[model samples]
Target: MPEALAILQKYWQHDTFRSLQKEIIDSVLSGHDTFALMPTGGGKSICFQVPALMNEGICLVVSPLVALMKDQVANLQNRGIKGIALTGGIKQDEIIDLLDNCQYGNYKFLYVSPERLQSDWILDRIKNLSINLITIDEAHCVSQWGHDFRPAYLKISELKKHFPKIPFLALTATATPRVKEDIITELGMHNPVQFEKSFARKNIAYMVFEVEDKLFKIEQILKKNPQPSIIYVRNRKSCLEISSQLQTLGFKATFYHGGLTSREKDKNMQLWMEEKAQVIVATNAFGMGIDKPNVKTVIHIQLPENIENYYQEAGRSGRNGEKAFAVLLTSPSDSIQAESQFINVLPDKAFLMSMYNKLCNYLQIAYGEGINEEFTFNLNHFCHKYGFPTLKTYNAIQFLDGQGIITFLKEFSEKITLQFLIPSKEVIRYTSLNPNDEEIILTILRTYPGIYEIQAAFNLPLIAKKSHHSEAEILAVLHKLNEKGIIDYHSKNNDAVLIFNEIREDERTINKVSKHLIRQNELKKEQLQSVLNYVAEKNTCKSKMILNYFGEKATTNCGICSYCITQAKPKKDFSTLSNKIMALLQNEDLSSREIQNKTKNTADDVIFVLQQLLEDNFLIIQNNNKYTLKT
Candidate 1:
């Protein structure tokens, strides 16, 4: 076996490489700068991982998300391959220890966020490590034209100055032609070898439907497919409501959203992964770094903000090379709603300046004195106090974070600690009286061995699972204990944290990056328009449209899409369609849906014929909104 194949079999337990995997690996092994443009499920990680394993020293990976970094590190460690991630919320001393492990403890991978590279201390430490290769995940972020542009990514090329001889590998799931050019130029790749897998999934059918009742359509689709599936919603409320509704309708369903505690998210995800639940309703936070091969369908009930996000989400299905469906359900009001949610909330230069000033005031930071200061931020309370709109303010903060003016970490959970105040015998007696709390109290005591001697933080979800209770119930018991002076409990909830990277110059800070901000807003508008056009388009094949958007020209129509199916049917003359519609109404008054069902014609053709009939005075609508022959 090839050395790469041997490494893959040992670590990943796979025999063969997917399409373009071997070629990309070979390019990297040959010591050339490589760029791999694979789709969401194309096994991009293996392209760099296998070759790095074959090399002598550790591979340094720079990624954008903390969760993604931690997940990759955990997976590597599970395979008995040592790895470390320098993610957010780590203290200086802990970072030193992790970096030491990377340098001397025989670690194979070191994953860090792009922002971490800016620290001189970290760069100096990294300079001393025996680096073999540098991998940049989500490489499109280096491009300003990319859907998710980050200024931190632009600084990644600085690593070349330190590791000039080490080969660089850049990987991304989706990128446009412009973004591709930008990545190459910005990273300063030295004559890189580029490998791009076609963005078309032949096994997955892309279907779009315009319907009046989205829930009814969703039910019909789920009932027909009846396999493991995912339904993507736009908010936490929708995740809960849809999952509950599906459960009530006799389907094993669960939900996930950003608001869910870590334990809740893990429990719900486990149910879906183990196939105990038939469907998972979730917001966009659910699918990153997740690969489930048997997913037969992925349904989006609303229009996605952009085609890049939509394609990546829809591409999550049919990974097993089996027939699957990517269904998009849109109502008449969806276009307006999508525009309001995505486009209108984009922050312009004026809004950014105002938001920055308001944020400093909210955090009580004085001008030119608040550099390097961090504070807990509650977005809802801040917005309420200042009478500012929530969504726009959130977008402005995100823009500032991307610009490197500040660091905004959302959904930041604070530490929860507890310690026993009474003696062990007294606690046992109290628990015996409250038998309901006995299991949880004992489980916590067992899990944290030092709880009796000192305050210790515990995993609420793990205790809930061990004691057979919900997190809320566990919290209630703890509260009761604390109120009775049996234990000292402390907990805090901060929605986000803001770290000011620069001193407060307010308007001057905004002025430095105003041009880039305006350009980014324009890019967002253009991306939104592309999604709208994709939804409104009916003549072209959906798969071909996506390919064309990504700079690939696909000539053949995918026969499985809704547009192709409609085109493949035998075309009926206008008179034939009109006659069929008229015949359906002659039996009794019928709605458009009934006419389309009886006539077995496409909805567009039926609607066109119905309009002609109505205009010709051959059909009349009654008070019930049903059509009939003119009297």
Candidate 2:
């Protein structure tokens, strides 16, 4: 414990565990299966990270996020800990060698994405190593009701069957009461201890703006607060468009989406981290495992899918525990859009069957024979091929995944280099080499360090720089070396290809309805409530509402929200918003979009006034969608 504390103080600069971390750690120490529900920015990693070092054997962490798995492994390596992550980005043999280290050497941890759990070699070999703790990060994915669900998570429970005596831990940043219960029940945890921290960030002020021109509203928001920010959009195209627009406006902006190549993602992320890019317009894929402090604002140009997602995105702000802002720029059609999202979630059994049939039929699949089949699913191509609408088709696939009928993953290719260098004689003798002139031969061994010491990945650029060679030269060197029976490499930039195993029907039948659909619905309603709470708050305390949402009973208000800002005003006397129509018309006659943008009132009131204007002949609709003062 003392050593752990000292290490924490040196590395993370913290002295002790926060909230239930100690108890959770103790539970694992006692060999109990523990479930931790720490919110985003809360210390989920440390719970397992600390314990892994203290325990006798390595801890096997199963995570769903591929980038996060890589990140954690990288971070541990950075901190001088012996860790390895088995991602497709590395060659299969490297994974096998890493596993060998876990069994025989000082390797303390192995992080793997859940999808790898089903691999035949992984499953068979993992049991040979003495695993002290097994942790499932994002445990909520195991629940059928989570917004970010993955079919791969279902295999976690089977670990108990394999390692009956090993301690188990499940961790997630977001989960409702129902999902929490489902996690425990599904995983069959043994009298697990539950620890849930407050999800609220009191220093972050949540505000919503209804605007006609979203880009204009976003621009105004940037002008108003004007600090390092993240603009989250719903899709890749929007991420591209908004990022370009922000760049054009002279703001240093970058974008991230699933569409970007690994190299592009890494470069953009590095720029953002260095603060060279002040704004990152991204789809939801950008935030996990990112710990950027001093992010002054988080703007959602389109509403996020739920409050859990919103809270997570917003929590990225004020991480320094300083005051920051989380603004949601709303369009008039937002409500309808929310409903449309829900519409996709609530597909019936027929829709499920039809969608499944279409996919199978398109592939020329024959009923039960198509079971366990894998195919490269290109969403746009599939939709266009079958003349299906994009959103609905996407939703149908998600619904199928929720029911545990199919699996869908965006493509991931891997690039890897060894940090551990084998002796030149060993490399030559191990493969019984034939050629002395192989350039790739000497490049790889010197690039990595002590082979016997179990090194992980090294930076490719650093290797190239040290070797006095260009990147292409390094690549060619590694390629030849891999072919010359020296080392191996994994390339992930390749297209998405599916692999099927066992070609059998699904083991269990589902109701075609998952609790995820219901929970997602309730979550949307909860987000709407959050928006309502922000707008209708009369008390000066915005912090209290957020606390309440996180199940915290913070009785006192922080007195710094929009509510507090507006509370000092004498209540508006706009009894009917009944100012002289002349007061509103004081400006050059405004268009309906303009008039609506300027008011604090609802659409009904805005339209009611426009009607009165028409009654008094105070306004005129001229030249299509424009409105103006009467001539």
Would you list the C-alpha lDDT of every candidate in the order shown? Answer: 0.89, 0.71
**Model 1 C-alpha lDDT per residue in residues 1-631, reported as the tens digit of each score:** 3499899999999999999999999998888999989989999999888888898889999998878988988999899999999876677899999999999999999998888898889999999999988999999999999998988898999999888888899999999999999999999899999999999999999998876557767787899999999999999899999999988888999999888877689999999999999999999989978999999999999889788999999988999999999999986579899889988998888888888898898899998978768888899999999888999998999888887788887764756899999999998998889888898999998898889899898677788899899988999998899999999999978888888878999888999889888889899899989988988898999999999999999989999998998888897678988887777777889877787788888666776687779889999867665789998
Q: Write model 2 residue lDDT over 1-631, tens digit each, in one string.
A: 5456765676667878777888888788888888888888887899998878887789999876667987888898888888888764455778888889888988988888776788768888898888889999989888766656666687778899999998889999888777888889888788887778776676888766555557766776677766778999988898989999988988889999988877789899998889899889999888978888898889888766667787888888878888898877765467677666654445555555566667776766664676556676567777788777777777767655544455555664444644324556676665445343233345545554454355446466666666667777767766665675455455434334433332323222223244454555565566665654554454536566666655567776565665665565565444355454446666666655666667666543565566666678877756543556676
Given candidate 2, what's the lDDT at residue 299?
A: 89
Over the full model, what C-alpha lDDT does candidate 1 score relative to the true structure?
0.89
Clashing pairs in 2: 89-414, 145-516, 413-492, 414-492, 419-449
**How far in Å is the alpha carbon of 225 misplaced in model 1?**
1.1
Q: Which stretches of candidate 2 lie over 4 Å from their true place?
A: 9-20, 86-98, 113-124, 149-155, 161-165, 345-347, 361-377, 399-407, 412-495, 501-550, 572-588, 591-631
Report the Cα lDDT for residue 452, model 1: 88
